[model samples]
Target: MSCFEILDPAFGRFVLGNAALKQLATGFDWVEGPVWFGDAGCLLFSDIPNDKILRYTPGVGISTYRAPSNYSNGHTRDRQGRLVSCEHGTRRVTRTELDGSITVIADSYQGKSLNSPNDVVVKSDGSIWFTDPHYGIGSNYEGFAADQELPCNVYRIDPDGTIEAVLTDFNCPNGLAFSPDETLLYVADTGRMYQDDPAHIRRFSMESGRPKSLGIFHTIAPGKGDGIRCDMDGNLWSSAGDGVHCIAPDGHLMGKILVPEKVSNICFGGRAKHQLYITATTSLYAITLNRVGAQTP
Candidate 1:
């Protein structure tokens, strides 16, 4: 029952062996994105099919942060502490300013509408990065269906409002994150669509603040993974069909945290930033861990 046996080697010194998973809330169609707001002391996550964003805290329980959330899929905070979100319904990326107004980041490129904005992350330089897939347009359940007019690609919205395609050739890019040092970028390709053999997570070498080389990082043996994040030590914590998998920075399979439901996304928050908040399908769960997430970089 040692904590080291339950978490990645990088996290062995952090999570207690006996820490128990705590259920926070339930009753949603599907939960996907999760972002922690330390300033507000709450965790915000998406219930995609429900078209809503929900907030959870230790005392107040669950509350609707935003209804009709444009079927948002993924979310993160900019360095300025603004909420940035990826919208499936609109096939665009947006930001919520402090003054409570929405600014569309990217809805189209080269006069073509994006397929679906799935997951998002922001860099220290105010560049917005996101994944575009066809999940939103594959059916009418999560958003309006339409012919996909764009390739499944990763895009970067520069600080000056210029949009640039960062990566392409992905079949289904679902989740993404940067290594603690920002030298490597990891993205999950659920690949549930084409390509009989799909990659779970792919790593790209970053040069001059851009991705220059691409390689397969790790592929889950059975099911798929999504919404990956890194710890202070560079271990990737990814959501899986079974639960959560922690892979070492050296591509070693570390350990896992088991949950009753399929987890879609996760974030670190709480008093010491040691709390791991998980957005499982239809439910939200958390557990105290021994490590802290990598600060946005």
Candidate 2:
């Protein structure tokens, strides 16, 4: 049986006919973020419910990278190659230094504690962008339940350590990524989990160093968009209930990669950045593609 549901002819060139989707590992409570460390030849990800960050190597299999990781959810590398992460348990965003020290990036805004930090990304200018949602604090499953001190919002941290709420209108800003040239930013709003809101991704143009909304980019069916990433060609690859949806630059569904379980997040990795690493409900999966991920800066 075919592993893909091709919706448009353009998507055919992006996929490899001989490449088979491979399940890398399983037995996690709930896996979310997946980041590639090319220099170390490993993939690091968050197993949220387990309160651990797991690492997967090409030939070494899965191992514990960091246990009791403060229920971290999403991760990315800064331009300097240091790890930047969102910690649900701590309700903060942190950066892991080369010497193994952890630096708190942002935990509060305007003297009030922020909602749990969800997903994160770093721009070429050394700025850190992330989502603050209540999912982690909504229950005791992923993080400690507590009163939300701040509204769910998207934030940006300047290289000088100034914190600002870039977008304030999202019900729940989940995953986000920048376009190839960093001219456009795509953010997923998975507010349907709490109310009768739309489950879609919004596109915004960078104007005056802030995001100017371009309106709803695309809405996901079957399930809401949980995480999203962009390819070098400006295609947005988003996570869905059934699998991963590849949307073209023009806001059209290009194709779908069928997964047996729900996908929470994904990242382009491997030697040439041609391997798409996926973090599903209970397992980690990957498939080779004919595309490369957008380089940082």
For model 1, the superposed segments whose C-alpha errors exceed 4 Å read 1-11, 192-197
Taking all chains together, each candidate's TM-score versus the true structure is 0.95, 0.98
Best by lDDT: 2
| Predicted candidate 1 versus true structure: per-residue lDDT over 102-221, tens digit per residue | 999899999999998999988878888899989899888888989988889989899999998888878888899988788899998887454574667899988887887577888865
Q: Which residue pairs come into collision in candidate 1?
A: 14-290, 15-290
> Where does the lowest 10-residue lDDT sum fall in candidate 2?
191-200
Worst 10 residues of 1 by lDDT: 1-10
